[model samples]
Target: MDIKLDAAALEAFLRAEFPQVAGEYTVDRLTEDGLVLRMDVAERHLRPGGTVSGPAMFSLADVALYLAILSRIGPQALAVTTNCAIDFMRKPAAEGSMTAEARLLKLGRVLAVGDVLLRSDGQAAPVARASLTYSIPPAA
Candidate 1:
């Protein structure tokens, strides 16, 4: 499918529609299948062990899929996640950022399915993987 929103447009849409989280993530690039997203890890994103928190990783995966969907379907803010299954594979580094490679598996009239693999910045192996399904709001 043709891309409806590029990196710049997606970022702008995030800032305008979801200001609370707009600063937490950056759109690194968009590919033929999906996009790359970078999450700026901060102290607040860590748990007591000094590693990235599960919730933080989940948020990265969630937003990555959300943006991936929006890139193809335009800024449909109402589109929401219907299901998510995540696996935390390894520990993430305490410092730097995390990158989520999100790819759309399926896009249909009412549902979109995607997968996300997250890795700590500069790391080789994925720290976590997630499969998500989103419910797309019917066009008005």
Candidate 2:
């Protein structure tokens, strides 16, 4: 699919449309079929064991997929996640950032499906994986 937004445009869209989470994530790059997003890990994202929390990782995956969809469909803020399933395979590193690589599996007229793999920076293996389905609002 053709990309409607680049990295800079996606970042601007996030800041303008969703300022609450704009600072938490960065658009690392936009690939042909997807994009890579980096989450700046903070103290609040940690669990009791000094590892990244599941919710935080889930947020990363969700936002990554959301942006991936927007990159193709333009800034459609109403596009919502209809279903999501995530698997936490291993513990993430305590320090540094986590990157989520999200790719769209299918982009139909009303629904988009994607998968995301999250890994701690510098790690070779993924810490988590997620599959998500998003409902795209019909054009006005």
Off by over 4 Å in 1: none
Q: What lDDT, from 0 to 1, does candidate 1 have? A: 0.95
C-alpha local distance difference test of each model: 0.95, 0.96
Sequence-dependent TM-score of model 2: 0.98
Q: Model 1 over residues 25-137: C-alpha lDDT tens digits?
A: 99999988889999988999999979999999999999999999999999899999999999999999989999999999999989999999999988999999999999999
| Model 1 alpha-carbon miss at residue 98, Å | 0.3
Candidate 1: Cα lDDT at 20: 99
Worst 10 residues of 2 by lDDT: 25-34
